[model samples]
Every structure is written in structure tokens, then in C-alpha cells.
Target: MNDFPWLSVLLVLPLLGAITVALLPRGRDALAKQTALGFAAATAVLGIVLAFRFDSGGPRFQFTQSTPWIEAFGVDFALGLDGVALTMVVLSVVLVPLVILASWRDAERSGGTGVPPKRSVKTYFALILALETMMIGVFAATDVFLFYVFFEAMLIPVYFIIGSYGGPQRSYAAVKFLLYSLFGGLVMLVSVLWLFPLSSRKVSEGGLGAATFSFEELSGMTIEPTTAKWLFLGFFLAFAIKAPLVPVHTWLPDLAQQAPPGALVLIVGVLDKVGTYGMLRFCLELFPGAAQWATPVVLGLAVLSIIYGAILAIGQVDLKRLVAYTSVSHFGFIVLGIFGMTYAGQSGAVLYMVNHGFSTAALFLLVGFLIVRRGSARIDAFGGVQKKAPVLAGLFLVAGLSGLSLPGLAPFVSEFMVLTGTFTQYRVAAVLAAVGIVLAAIYILWMYQRTMGGPATEQVSGLSDLSVREKVAVAPVIAVIVVLGFFPQPVLNVINPSVETTQTVLDRPGFRPQITGDVAENGARP
Candidate 1:
């Protein structure tokens, strides 16, 4: 199993599917949808197989493969997975088919009430499959250069998806998304280029002996403190924009308002995770000293994002924008967990990524259904939805509650872990961050009441319940949320080991471990 090219195959399957879907003759939209769904499902099955074969206690990086690509620069076509990467891979694969299913009618002219998609149905599905390939590749790439390639290349399909198939302001939104991402990428590229010469220099001169982009090699090398901080900032800027943390998070609500709901699912649900994941995998691992140096400021920004996002969400008139703001808030929690620098904190942060994906996906899809029914995304455009579509209302409520991290839901456990872990170290920050939870309940319930409660308004009185396809699309996500809420130990078991490895990296001298008085007394550091 270790000898198999698991990650390569996982990436290729979706790429091949995209090509096959695109090449099919015109007027076969149904066939294209089926073909794309089949390919996504197959890729998902492979991901599951890979996950089951993963040994939690085995080598840090399993199913590894490395082959020189640009040998002159020591870059390689490398791919590998630790527990964290594996969990993310599984999340991406599992969501793609579900997104495909939910978006079954997204490209068709008669699919819904809003302005129809301008692109061909076949092209739409093809873009989705192509995006899947990029998502998997970004998570799997073990070479820094290869990871950057996947990172920037992701913009292509997403650009087209939003600009071509999205709503009235899509072109503007797409351009904004592109420009922000491109600038971040360019800055990071400068940092990436800088690493080569540094790596080529001799160890006595603070070099790693050979120029290389292999993550494992680079992580093990030591760079000057000032140089490491700059590199760390470069990478952190890219991830932060992607994470869309406060201040830099301006692009997301605009994108969410304009993008098709299905595309939005992958954007917030999975794509945005690349930022948080990079913070966990690259930033902290490669520059532990800088990471520790930046902890105080990072935690401050995270707490600010948490409050700012929730407050804005409370004032949103548009359903899609409301969900988008909620995500900004949720991401703050993820970031908070990460910088807390404790085992429980990092582990919870990782699990939060997966759980948030499902909950946010469900919210966006349900909102999409509402928009389709009424031809508007405004909260005022809906009323007494429950009277006409009980199932839709019920499901929306459950998804909404999950977003608020209600007890016995998937998000609650992860949220709790993150707070528990962070509280032990950064007590004030954790306490301040908890305020976001209260605000979350306000925004979520208020949105639900306006959209789903009360007497059936004439406009929404005729709203139909979820169709069979819609039900099938959302059932699995909801099930996962409920199941994981009660039994998260399984997922935690897989995530804890990798987080332990990360803790080991962060535990070097000069980093403080404030998790408990006993640890401080014992002279333990992180």
C-alpha cells in the first residue's frame, strides 16, 4: 500500500474526468453531469481507501512519493500525506460529489428562477472536475514549488466559474478575487525564490547544503532569524488572504453574493482551508521561531475577526452574504485554535476545518434552494418558509444551529476543543473569542426567523419543499454533522498524531508553553 501512488492517482482521476466531460459531444448535458458525478464518486472512493490504509502511529508522512522535476533547482514532483493532509483530502473528495449532485441543475437555463448561467452545462461540470484536481493537488503536494503551482493554478477554474456563471456583479467579484490572490501569490513567490540561494549556501554560512523545494528538507534546515521572519510573513500573507482573515477578508462576502451556490461551497467549504492548512503545515513547521514571535499579533487579529464577522452577519440583508460573514467568523475560531500552540488547540483546529466545511456547505445549498424558489437572496424576500416547506426550513435550522456550534452537533465538539485548548494558554484571548459564540447565535437565529419563521407571505406561500435530488445532496452532510457530534473520537484519533508532531516542532527553546502552571514549573516550552 505504501508503494502505491495514491496521491497521484487521486489527482489524476479528477483531471481525466474533467477532460472526458469536456470532450463529450454537445447537447449531452445529462451525460456530462452523470460522467462528472461518476468520476467524482470514484475519486472519493479512492480517497476512502487511502484513508483506511493510513496508519495513525506509522511514519509522519505516509504513501510518500518524490521524483525530481526541475532538478537544477532541486524541485520535485512530490506528494505525501500526514494525518492532517489525509483528513483534508478525504474532506475535499467527499464534498466534490455532493457539490456536483447539489449543482445538478446549476448550469441549465430552466434550472431555477434567477438569471440563468451563461455558460454551457458541459463546461460547468468540466470546470468543477478540474477544480477538484487542483484542490486535491494543493493538499497532496509535498514540494514547496509544486504546492505553489497548485495554489496559484486554482484561480483559473474559480475565476471562470464566478465570472461566467455567477450573478449580476460576478465579473467585478471575480476580478477582485483574482487580483487579491495574485498579489499574495507574487509576494510569496519572491519568498520562495529567496529560499533557493539560501538552501544552496553551506551550513557554516547558514545554508542547508543544497538548493531544494522539498518540504521535508527545507523544514529541517535552519535559516537566519530575520530572514526566516520575512519568509514567514510572505507565506503568512498568502495564507491570510486565502484564509481571508479580518481586514484582508473583504473579498469573500462580495464573491459569495455573486457566485453560484455550488461554487461558493467549494470556495468557503474547501478552498479557503488551504490558507489555514498552510499556516499549520508550512508556516509553523518551517519557521518555528518566527511563528512563536508572531503568536501575540496573530491571536489579536483572530479575536478581532471573530467579533467583526459576527457583528456584520447580524446586519446582513442578503442570505448568501450572511452565510459568508458567518464563515469569516468561523475561520477566526480556526485561526485562534492554530496559534494557541497546544495539542488540543491544533487538533481541534484541524477538525473544525472538516466540520465547518459540511455545515457551511449545507447552509449555502439550502440558501441556494430558497433563492431558486423566490428568485431573490434577500432575507425580506422570504417569510413563513416553514409553512410551505417544512423540510427545507427544518434542515436550514439544523445547519444554522450547527453554524452556531450548538451542543451535540459536529461543530460543537471541535469548537469546544479549540476553546478548551486555547483557554489553557491564552486565557484572555480565549475568553474574548467566546463572545463570538454568543454573536453567532444571534446572527444565525435572527436570519432563520426572518427567512423561515412566521406566517407564509404570499411570495413564499407557494414555495415547494426540497426535491428528491436536493434531499439526497444534503442528507449525507447533515448525517455527518450529527454523527461526528456524538462520536468525534474516530476523527480525533487520526488528527492528534500529526498535531503531536507539530507540537514537537514548536516545543524548542525560546517558545513558551503556557498551557498550565505545572508545565511552566517543570520548564517545558513550546
Candidate 2:
């Protein structure tokens, strides 16, 4: 099982599905959807098997497969997984089938053709599978060039999905997204090119030092302070835009407003994490000194995003946009935890990435259900929905509580770890960042109160509760959130070694565990 090419199969399976869906006959929209779903489910099942079989105590990059691609340039078709990448791969694979199921009637809901057109259901689903391939590949690629290839490849399907299947303002939103992403990519390209020479070594036969784009090679090479700063900024700028911290985050609100709910799941729940993932994988790992140099500025921006996103979320008239803004705030905490550079903080950041996906996906899917019912996304249009749809209201409350980091919820554990870790290092920033938690409570409870509570409004009075399909789509996410909350130890055990290994590479000196003496005195009794 360990020797099997699981990562390769995981990466290729979706691409193969995309191709198969594309080849299906013109009128076979139903078959195409089924084919896509089948493939996604299979990929997800494989991911589960991979997780169960993963040797948590083994090598950092597991199931690594490498083959020379551009041997002259030292590029390779390399794929591997660490605990972080594995977790993300699982999240990506798991979400695809759910998105497919959730989007069954999305064309009709978006006022587009229900029957398949030339650019039809087949195309939509094919794009999704293609996107999944890119998502997994980006996380798994060990070669810098391969990672960049997957990174850029992702934008294509997403651009089409949003522009073609979204609301009236879809084109504008899609174009804006493309332009921002392209600009970031161009800047990062410079850094990638710069590294070819720096990471290259003396080739055999005394021709020249051949440039290599392998992460393993690059990570071992020495970079001067000035060069590292420039390179770090290049990667950081790209990630920040993707992460959409504070000023660069304008694209998300538009995307949330225009994109179909199913698309938003990938965009918010899985795809956007690429930014933070890049920060950890490339920025910190490759440019440790630059990371330390940029810490204060990064932390400041993170704090700003937290307060800014929370305040804007509170003020939103559109429910979808409100969810998007809340993500901005949540992302702030994730970044804060990552840059905190403590073991607990980094591990918490990874867990937060996972927990945020489920909670946010539930919120989007449930709210999408409401939009379909009332034909609106406005907070002012809804009131006393709980009276007519108690089940929906209850689900919304659960998701909202998870979003606000309520105790006994999945997000709470990660949030607590982040703050605890941050407090140990940067006390003032942690204190200020703590205010976001308060604001989170305000926005989440207030959103629930406004949208789900109060007297039954005319708009909501006739609205029906979740259908069976809707329940099926959302139930898994809700269950995962609750289950992971009480059993976070399993995830932490996997994440701790990776985080510690990263800290070791960076050589960051920090405090020993305060619980060590207490635990020893108590003789391991909890």
C-alpha cells in the first residue's frame, strides 16, 4: 500500500475524469454529471485510504514520485505529500463530489438553460474535475516549476466557471479576478526565474552549473539577504493577493456575490487556501530570514484584515457578501497563527484551514438554499425564517456558531491554539487580534438573529425547509465540524511533527512547553 503510486493516481484520476466527461455525447448531460461525480467520489475514497494508510511517524514527504521532465533545466514531474499537503489533498478531493451534487440544478437557479447547451453541463463538470486536478497537483508538486504549472493552470477553469455560470455581474467579477491573479503570477515568475541560477549546481562533465527547480535543491541553497528579501516580496505579494489580505481582498466580495454557491465552495473552502499554503511551503520554507524580516509588517496587516473584514461583514446588506467578508477576517487569524512561528500556532493554522472550509461551505450552501427559496440574497429581505424553517435555522445557527469559534466547536480548538501560541510570543498583537473574536461573535450572532430569528416575514413564510438533497449535501460538512471539534488530537498528532520540522529548518528559538513540569509531577494522569 505504501509503495503504490497513490499520489500520482490521485492527481491524474480527476484529469482523466475531466477528459472522459468531455468526450461524452452532446445530449448526455446527466451521464456527464454522473461520470464526473463517480470519478470525484472515487478520488475522494482513495484520499481516505491514503489518509488511513499514511505513516504519520514516517518521512515528511510520503509517497513521493519523481521523474525527470526537463532534465536540462532540472525540472521534474514530482509529486509528494507531507501532513499539510495530505490534509489539503483530502479536503480538495472530498469537496468535489459534494459540489457536483449541490450544483445539480444550479443552471436553472441561475436563470440559465436547464437543458444542456453546446457549452453545457458537461463543460461545467469537466471544468470542476480539471480544477480538482490542479488543486491537488499544486499541493503535491515537489518541484517549483511543477507547482507553478499547476498554480497557473487552476485559473483557467475557475475563470470559465465564474464567468459563464454566475450572476449578472459575472464577467466583471471574472475579469477582475483574472487581472489580479495574473499580476501576482507575473511578479512571482520573476522570483521563480531568479532561483534557477541560485539553486543550480555544477553539472557533471564540466559544462556549467545547471539550474534546478526542485524544492529540495532550492531549500538547501544559500540566498543573500538582499536577494532573499526581493524574492520573498515576490512570493508574498502573490500569496497576499490570493489570501486577499485587507486591501487586496476586494475580489472575494464580488466573487461571492456573482458566483454560484457550489463554485464558491471550491473558491472559498479549498482554492483560496492555496495562498496560505504557498506562504508556509515556499515563503517560509525557502526564505526563512526574509520571513523573520517581514514578520512585523505581516502581523500588522493580519490584524488589520481581522478588524476590517469583521466590521465590513457586520455592515453587509447581502448575505453572500457577508460570508465573504467574514472569510477575510478568518483568514487573518490563519495568517496570524502561521506567522506566530510557534508549534501550536502553526499546527492550529493548519487545523484552522481545514475547519474554516467546512464551516464556511455549510454557510454558503445553506444560504444558497435560502436564496433559491426567496429569490434574493439580501439580509433586509429575510426575517423570522426560523418560524417557517426551523431545521434550516438550526443548521445555520450551528454553522454560525462554528464560524464564531464557539466552545466545543471545531473552529474553537484551532482558534484557541492560535491565540495561545500568539500570546506567548507577541502579546500586544495577540491582544488586539483577540478583538476579532469579539467582533466575530457580533457578526455571526447578529447575522443569525437578523436572517433566521424574529417574526416570520412575508418573503420567508411560504419558504420550505431543506430538501433531502440539500440535507445530504450539508450533513457531511456539519458532522465533520462537530466530530473534529472533540477529536482534534488525531489531526494535531499528524500536524505537530511537520510544524516542528519547519521550525527546526527555520531555526526559530522559542519557549519550552509550560505543561512539561506539571505533566511530569502528575505522572501522566489527566
Candidate 1 lDDT, 365-443, residue by residue in tens: 8988888788788999999999999999999999999999999999999999898888878989999999999999999
What is candidate 2's TM-score against the reference? 0.94
lDDT of 2 at 359: 89
Candidate lDDT (C-alpha), each = 0.91, 0.86
RMSD of each: 1.8, 4.0
User: TM per model?
Assistant: 0.97, 0.94
Each prediction's number of clashing residue pairs: 0, 0
Candidate 2: lDDT over CA atoms? 0.86
Off by over 4 Å in 2: 111-118, 201-210, 508-526
| Model 1 spans > 4 angstroms off | 109-113, 202-209, 513-526
